[model samples]
Target: MKKYAFAASAATIALAVSGQAFAQESDAFSTALADGAVTELAPVTVTTPLRRPTTVLQSTSTVTVITEDDIEKSAAPDLPSLLKRYPGVNITTNGGQGATSSIVLRGASASQTLVLIDGMRVASATSGTAYISNIPLSSIARVEIVEGAHSAEWGADAIGGVVNIITKDGSTCENGASVCTTVETGVTYPWGGYGTVSTRGVSNSGVNFNIGLSLLGTEGYDFTTADNSVHEDGRDGFLQGAFNFALSKDFLWGRLYTSGLYVRSNPHFDSAPYADWMTGETVYGANEADQTNAAFKVGAEVDHSDTWSSVFELYSAFDYQKNFRDGHPEADTHYDTNRYGLSASTTKEIQAGAALNTFTLGAEAYRETVDSSVEYTETARDVAAVYGQYGLELDALTFNAGLRYDYDEQFGDAVTYNVGLGYELVEGLTARASFSTGFNAPTFNDLYWAYDGSYVGNPDLEAETSKNWEVGLNWAPTDTAAIDLVYYENRIDDMIAYVSDPVTYIGTMENIDKAKVSGVRATYSQMLFDDRLGLDFGFEYRLPKDETDDVYIANQNRLKLTAEASYAATEKLNLNAGIEYVGSRWTNADNIEYTNYAQYQLGAYTLVNLSAIYAIDETANVKFAVENLFDEEYQTAYGYKAPGTTVTLAYRRTF
Candidate 1:
């Protein structure tokens, strides 16, 4: 689940899902507060993950936080590329930038993981995937990644986990400043450039507001190789424009706020068309896609005390896309998916002797609809849910438990729950464990799409479900050093996938079989040399297996390792370097015909990046970065060429 913070006063406010940049004198992934430092962050979610105010160390689930400083240092132009640096995350893209991508968190498929921007959904119902490539990095301030099942708190589509992105609310201006604005521009390799402008201000009447704008475009390279016989090869291009707006006012009763983000992207991809397909000859076409993504929310928070509060909100989000092909207008298709919802919740805290206890109850309702060129049996579905949670913090023990009941118009009813506990074995060391259950609803395209030439839909598909078991430890023996390790196993039942008949080769969606994933993730962070140099290392080993076939999962890596270092070489220069390694993976789901499981595999590779920032003055700086310094050739999938070594140079100024 994601949490938001509401300022008690109008002057001190930040609008986001979670986190504060530079708040972590420690590892930003764990807790934000440093040793003996004041936790002066906004009042609520900058430290919370389960809807109430608490530090990251107090959370029972496996969590990772990427602050604004981390984002700026990565120098990644797209969201997917930036997310790959963290542990427990694996990315698989169809081609180069602006191509479709799958974010497999803890071995969960793209459709099973939930993504939120400022606590609202932006994924398409048809494909069950978010267009993360369309989300500009300039619009984000922080990101939180939670692993394992969490349907008890967030509802469906959380069978795997959740990714919550928080954007700037403009509270980071100079002390007591009434208005502030910043402009940034960059030129990147492989032919691309971008620019963004952001401003945040508060009025004397206690009305706060923020506005941001960004534009980006790239002249990409050929996505496919000549070895494939599908079509001709050429360059692909991508362009996007986006905006963000937020407004809030302090009232005597509560704080009222409204916020939204909108993005329009035009992307070109290699396709087969133009020439008549009935001729049975290969034909190349100039193809492009137009995509629109938007999300908005209006809400109010009322706080009577630090631990007692309530909130009410209404939200709407949608993702629409239409494709264009030369001389094949009739073959081009479009999909429009929309969602609208409302929620209300309240939390109460009680003090009994030395123990603090809290309880929460909430209810939510949402409707989803799809409009497309294909004729389908169903077009709309509705969902309603009620949930309750209880938490206890007594002495060295921390505990949490939640239960939820949901009713779906298409899938009937479901109930999920989780219980977790953390115990302090020593002054700075803690051990924790949890058990949870989650579910994922089948998309309309999977359940009711009309039959096409090669693909069809089955209406008997069930909502995929999962159960997870986890245990971990957090050790912070010193202020500058920290270690976190966790082991988790998740089993999914009735997993949904498209199945093709061996004889006819006609594909239809169905409940394939059972699948399981088990893994261990570990991280170590330290600072040295008068705290001027920082180092962080992360490693993950996972085993993804299909219970039905007793074979390894396809395209899921078993090993991943990363190392990052940052140093202040001088007063004016800051340097950062990183290295990442991903293990080889099989590209085919079935390997019965292959020998020693060696055929149809994507080889492993290592990538290195370097970045530097030189301060021209107090308010100005220049950013220079090199990605894939060695230009290692690799592919996430068959017949697609990954990006090569590239360089990016940029300038930034603050006012």
Candidate 2:
């Protein structure tokens, strides 16, 4: 009972330090939505006859692709809300939309699971995690998710794998000249409303472009039930405005492109926890932040020949925040970061009797500068990296190898690599295996941050690394059916853990923990009734443990199962439903208080969702959806109540 009470009080503390960052690859995550009449139903991310319809990222055989169609028909309001419905993913939110959230992929925390928006990495240097909730689907084109590590190509941050976000662009136009507009509006059960206007076109001059504007606001419910010394009664609220644009043109020998995404949001949260802790006085009311995220990129892709190509780009990105308490500026705080980078890569393919060979070489350099209310010893850092890759394909076997070296001004030298192979075992079955190494660097807060009595920094912290191996099988009995089964293990060494003295109340970071994760993932997709009905299923079981503490990782479930069904009720009406089941998880990894009792467990929970889209015409449609169809009362985090049953209605049109 004591432990439960303490756990609840801890919820408020997370809101402040819980801000996170995400590392992304040069890739995508096949996202979630109602239009996936057949998601992950292909030999790769899609079935044959389908080459992802959209803008960037190289397609991989094991990735999952959620195309533009899926984004268009999605009923969920935010990305994280819908992400939980996919395989190898688990999500926990502080409350509703626009609130702080957490994502764990294949036992790797959010910081470990790389996040990329158009092949660009995004995250706050101090928080070490990405804020993805404010990115609306209205401005997106496609999302691809890869479940393992790609640090060899994406740097230390891609330790867990990658989730790529591709925004809307005119590059996919059928002809050299075309234009289209999409208007969408919707209302939610929490009494929120949203509207979006997006346009894309290619002109006669060969200038391709995409532009969009969106607004969303809601009277959200109190995001937490935790009780500190204060009381919060009013409903929390959320408001956001977003803008996106992309322009590109192809020349006889090359192509030039530029894209940008900017979003600003003010989300109300219960800051009573922090108020009482800070002022030692009773405070009541909703707290909020003027938060912003921005990214811009300009690049050129040169096609030297049919079998040779190269890409070079310059990019800049940042995350900003200013917190306000009880609508008063007296309690405000700020954190802002800026990053600029340059990258270039070239690929060459050649034919060698009976085998096709491909090679790639790339290099990149980036700098991060920070401005915060708290002064630190170091306010800037630089990273330079170079990498190479090779691939070979034969009649029955395929292989790939990659190597990368990085030099960080603060952390010094590090190297990473990956190797994988696949071979056909029978007419319809194939064996696959891979071995890889990856790492994650300590965040700015981990190494620098002026001493403030309670906590201090550790300039000696080292980078964390991982050794992983996996074996799997892919079987396609027929064009209409596909199956994948894999089992893997990962050992994370030099984990940066914070240790503190109980009596002195002083905390410091140290690389003293080692972690291990082993799991099995299996997925099956099949087409039924002549493709009118499609079904996809995924199952994963994992054991994420802390080798040093001799215990399992906290807040992570050991088993997860998911299923999705899409049915074309008629030529004009489509129906889709999804179900997710997550096994119980431990609430804490250790008993810091030594209460002589084991940790409590959050009970298992399941969610079911239903949605239907009725086409009014070729260019317009109406959508109705019900989330938490069963209203299962469950909490992904202790002391926090997840949203209950909610309904939504939306209308969309394209021309």
Candidate 3:
């Protein structure tokens, strides 16, 4: 049954992606697919918040992709809510949209998974990692999620894989020129109303542009036993604009991209467990936090000759953040990062049938400087790296290997490597295994950033290191059926951990040895009913041990299961549903024990959504969607409640 469901889901997605290409053919993911190898389906394209590299597969581990269609149908107000559809991934928050959202992958801490924005490292230099809840997804092109120990490919903070946010660039017009816009406004029964407006335009010069602004504010929802409702004061909005130019066709073929984002949100704290006895309200009720991020990049591909192609890029970014408590300034921070990288890769046809090989080599470097007024700190880190990747295929056997050497001011020198081999036993069956070594260098905040009388930084912290290995089998009996099973183990050496002394009330970061994780993942997709309906299923169990070898590390979960289905009810309408179950988890540091266990198992729930897009005319479109059809009461975080049921109606036109 699971396998059948998985196949159906894949079929539905294939249909959707294939059909959507007719409307917007210039999407990056679609463009990448035009050149890369196509597997059972295709790897999901994700640009984690870090401005490193766009990814398709976990490459080194497990990965999952959630499409833009899935986002619209789910009507999840924010990133945290939408990510709940994944099993091994957990989303916890205090309350409301754009609140403090924590993402725990494979029982790792919220700070373990590094979030990226179009390849740039956007994680807070002070907090180590940024909360995904506060980032809006209005203009998201797609999300690429890689799961596993990836401190190797990326630098610090990617103990788990990475979540890359790849935004949409401008699309080309078929005729003279065109522009489109959509505006939506809706009201929640008890909270309040929200609105969003987006516009995109393309000029005759082959320049594409897009801009969007959105606002969401709501009253709090009822807690398990509290009289004071979950409340959201002030409003949260994201403003983004991007432009793309063709440059030239012969001499310099390139594109220029730029984007700016700002978010100001009212802080919402966790409700006291015993709401009946607590007298004081959650502090920061009147607090506000603001973030401003801007990035600009110019990339060009010049043909030195016919066989060798080169890509050179120059980029710069600036970020500033401020937090206010009780309407007074509490902290302010500013960061500026500059980077320049160049890659020269070439492909040649070695043979026609027996074997083929492709190689890629590149050198890159970046410098980051951080200055803080509230914490009274100034720090800078520079890294220079050289890497190479090679892929070869011989009949039924395939191999991929990569190596990178990086020199950092704080960590000295480090080397990371990954190698994998896959063999095909039959037309539809293949087995593969891989082993990789990765490391995480300490962040600026881990060595600096101190406030109050209770905090300390560790300047001598050793780099966190890991050795990971995995074996798996993939089968596709037919084009309509597929399944994958993978088992993995990871050994982490000198893991970075923070310890707090109660008597002295002091907290400091330290390098602790002895950490390990082992897990198994199963995923399946299938098509049914003449490929009109589809289903997808995924299940994973991970045992991440701390220094004491306990699965309960802070607030991460050990078991996860996720399922999704979609049906093309008609040519004009589609119905989809998704549900995820997160098992019990605990935090020893916080002294919080989840009781009843089974009853407290997040109350297994389901969410059903329906969407219909109709073409009123050649250039006009009408879209309607409903989310949380059952109105189940649940919480992504410990005590914070999610929205009940919601609906959205929108209309768009192109000229």
TM-score of each: 0.91, 0.88, 0.79
List the global CA lDDT of all models: 0.77, 0.72, 0.56
* Candidate 3, 1-655: lDDT as tens digits: 0112212223334222311110000011111111233334334333231123222222324555555555555556568767776656777776555456677665555666777665556665556666565566665656666666554456556666677765555544322257666555555433555566666666567556766676666554443324234433333322222222222223354334454444444443432222333566333322345545544455655555554455566655555555544433322233433333333333332454777665556666777677665352447777777777666667777776777787888778888877877777786576777777767777667777565677777778877777778887766665655667788887777877777887987887888746677888776666667665567677778877775455445555677776666665654455566666666555353334446332233444556545555545545555565557678776655545666676656554554
lDDT of 3 at 76: 60
Candidate 2, 1-655: lDDT as tens digits = 0001111001111110000001111111121223333233111222110011211111222455555655544456688876777667788887788887767667877777777777777788888788888788777776666666678878866666677788889754322228877788989888998999987888879899989999999888876764423336677788999999999999989899999999999987776645357768755433788889988999998999998989999999898987877546566778888989999988888998998888889899999988988778899999999998877778767677889999998888789988877777786567777787888888889999788988998989888888877887766565545567778888889988889988998998999999899999877766566555566678889999999998888888999887777676676787777788999888787724336433377789998888888878767778898888898877787656678777889998876
Expressed as tens digits, the lDDT of each residue in 165-192 for candidate 1 is 8777756464246887878999988899
lDDT of 3: 0.56
* Ranking 2 against 3 by lDDT, winner: 2
Q: For each predicted model, how many residue pairs clash, with residues at least 3 apart or on different chains?
A: 0, 21, 29
- Output the number of the TM-score-best candidate: 1
Candidate 1 TM-score versus the reference: 0.91
Error of 2 at 63 (Å): 2.1
Best by lDDT: 1
Model 3: how far is 145 from its true place, Å? 1.7
Candidate 2 stretches with Cα past 4 Å from truth are 1-62, 171-177, 226-231, 273-286, 591-599
